[model samples]
Target: MIPHQWYIVLESREIKPGQIVGVTRFGERLVFWRTTEGELVCLRDKCIHRGASLAIGKHHGDEIACPFHGFRYDKTGKVTLIPANGKSSEVASYFHIKRYPVREKLGWVFVWWGESEPTHEPVYFDNVDESFSWSSSRHLWPVHYSRAIENQLDLVHLPFVHTNTIGRGKKTLVNGPVQVVRDGNIAFWVYNEVDHGQKPKKAEDLPPPDFSRQHIHFIFPNMWQNYILDKMRVLVAFVPVDESHTLIYLRVAQKFVRLPLLRKLVDFLALRFSQVVLHQDERVVITQIPIATQLHMEEKLIPGDLPIITYRQMRERLKNV
Candidate 1:
């Protein structure tokens, strides 16, 4: 994971009001809960004194009580009360666990995973708004988050991997995939065609990007958007669970249908179909060697891999910042 960036770790619906949930994210055991007033809180799951998991403890107002010895902790992970020491005793300063800064945006839970303070809010696609109705689904992949992200940027696998669906036209020749990078994000246009004994064009020779046509947008770290149409889009968040696991949160958003019930039905069916398309890519992505990707690799690259190459290059630069 890149330091100092807000990484989406879970969906807002996963944790209900007055509910405390325990989950593993970023290779650490974590506990998340809402206070009586619905304020979000996150902390390490372990107790500092006895090494017990605090997730199973009871909630006392804005604080959580350790189940083992009845030690009470606040949202800041500081121990407030030790039952054995009586009510008048003051807890030591060193008896505390780690606390993480959390925020909620567009129905997603984001956590600050770096040593320094967060500089800004998480970056999201600006075009999507509340006017669009969306349906969401989750999938767990046995590969690193980087691998899952690159799969969406890859343009050469459509004809061979998804031949029956989106690649039905069998457009084997890839033209310039014009790309633009700004504010640590990438927006690119795809121009592919069928082979008729003609050479492919380079990105430099292609015309300027046509926003009126189909294009794809990606934000640094972990968010992607497939701009299928102005009113219809596919959004994905590649959440890291550990070094070799990723949880994909996929959503289909549309504004064509206005009726509430019919809109829901349409969103559901569209999401189901999107799942089919994603599974087709999943089957091959999981089998990739080394499970993770880096800026430099041993395999050869082609012109059609311009998006993937650009992603890697930018990722390398951001890892240090």
Candidate 2:
């Protein structure tokens, strides 16, 4: 969508060792694989020699051999050897495909979708330490990546769309002031004392609950994080397949549950519960007509829509950049 510098398309675990995974992102067919040395490679899925899908090819050590013509391509997307040509043939010099830069961190695979060399490392949760355990899942949404992203920045939807779970009988009206701040491509939102059907209390009149703080953040393009509590966090990334489709990756990070057996139990229960909540959001977001449309033309907004409005504006600015 935005002229890509870098877009995260999948988690590192999804692309296993010696395995090639075909990903259709931003309207392009990409093949991701790990070489024998454990390095990750991403290239157009189409073989340069005869246009065969590389996804159907086999991996030979650090190279992928085309199934149709037996043309072997190295991890760099360069033709290493073509059976149709002589061993001394310079054919490998002339046939090469585009190679995208990829990096794996925090169990996620990040691909640079833009033209320039990325100067910074991919973002990860620095706050996660020995106290936390993490697990993730992936879902494909039949909606634009922008739509999926806007849904994350939207705080107003919780009471209605997620009322049964996250909202849990809370007030539907958003009466608090929403704050937005940007640090480079990352943006953070703080919704203070938001009304959720409970009686409003004065700031000085209340004691802090076990997990009272609420915050959400957007890491440019398609990553989002919600600090649900001091011990729990949710990380989401939207992968664009085209103008009207996306693959959503969800990860639940948790802390304070230190016992090995108990951690596994907690993660399992938390992941399933989170999946239900996410599916509800997906059902509503994916069913919207036209997928992603001009915000002004699609719906009128009030104060509660401030986060959505800010998100759109930031997206527009990134597009222009």
Candidate 3:
């Protein structure tokens, strides 16, 4: 996994007040819950005392009480009240459990990974706001998080994997697929002109990204967006469940249908179509050899892979920065 970056792990709606949600992320067992006032809290799921799962414990206001010994903890992972001891007992400093910093933005939950304090707010795209109604779905992919991300960055596979859907015209040749990486964000545009049985044009020969057209982009950690049009988009958050598993949170957002009731119907239908396309990609992605990708992996690469190569380079650069 990449170091010192904010990764989107869950949608904001998944956690609710007075409830503890437990899941394994980044190969670590974690539990998330909200205080009565609705502030998000994330902590290691294990109780430091007997190594029991904290998720099964009871939640009282902001404090969660261990079911086995009645040890209670606050949002900061500090033991606030140990029922086994007197109510006025002072908890030792060593009694605290591990806590992780969390933030919510754009209806997604982000967790900061690594030791360094975050220097900037979580990065998100503009224009995709509450005005655009969204519907979300999640799927578990038995591949590394990087592989799931690189699948979207791949431009050459559309015609082959999605031949019956997005690749209807058989535009087998690729051109330009220019990329611009700046400010920890990467956006790339494709210029796929019907090949006249000629060699593909180099990335330098193509124009820079035209945001007005349909394109794809990646935000530093694990968020991605495909701008289908001015009022339509498809977003994906590739969550690293572990070294060999990833949970993809896919959402379809649109403002084309403004009426509330009609919009729900439209969004629902759109999501179904999106799911079909996603499964098409999933079938092929799961079969990739050595599911995890490396910056220096052995493969015959071509000029059409400029976006993917840039993504790998940026990931390597972010590891130290």
Clashes of 3: 0
Best by lDDT: 1
What is the TM-score of each predicted model, taking all chains together?
A: 0.96, 0.88, 0.96
- Candidate 3 has a TM-score of 0.96
Indicate the residue-level lDDT of 228 in model 2: 79
Worst 10 residues of 1 by lDDT: 207-216
Reference-based TM-score, model 2: 0.88
Clashing pairs in 1: none
Off by over 4 Å in 3: none
For model 3, what is the error of residue 134's alpha carbon versus the real structure, in angstroms, after optimal superposition?
A: 0.8
lDDT of 3 by residue, 250-290 (tens): 99999999988999998998888888889999999999998
Q: Which candidate would rank higher by lDDT, 1 or 2?
A: 1
lDDT of 2 at 214: 62
List ranges where model 2 is wrong by over 4 Å.
Answer: 129-131, 184-212, 294-296
Model 2 poorest 10 in a row by lDDT? 202-211
Tens-digit lDDT track for model 1 on 1-321?
778888889999998887888888889889999988888999999889888888888899999998899999898889999999999999999988899999988888999988787888777888888888899999999999999999999888889888998777889899987888887788888778899999898888888876556788889889899999999999999999999999999999999998999998999999998899999999999999989998888769887888889888888988977
Ranked by lDDT from best down, the candidates are 1, 3, 2
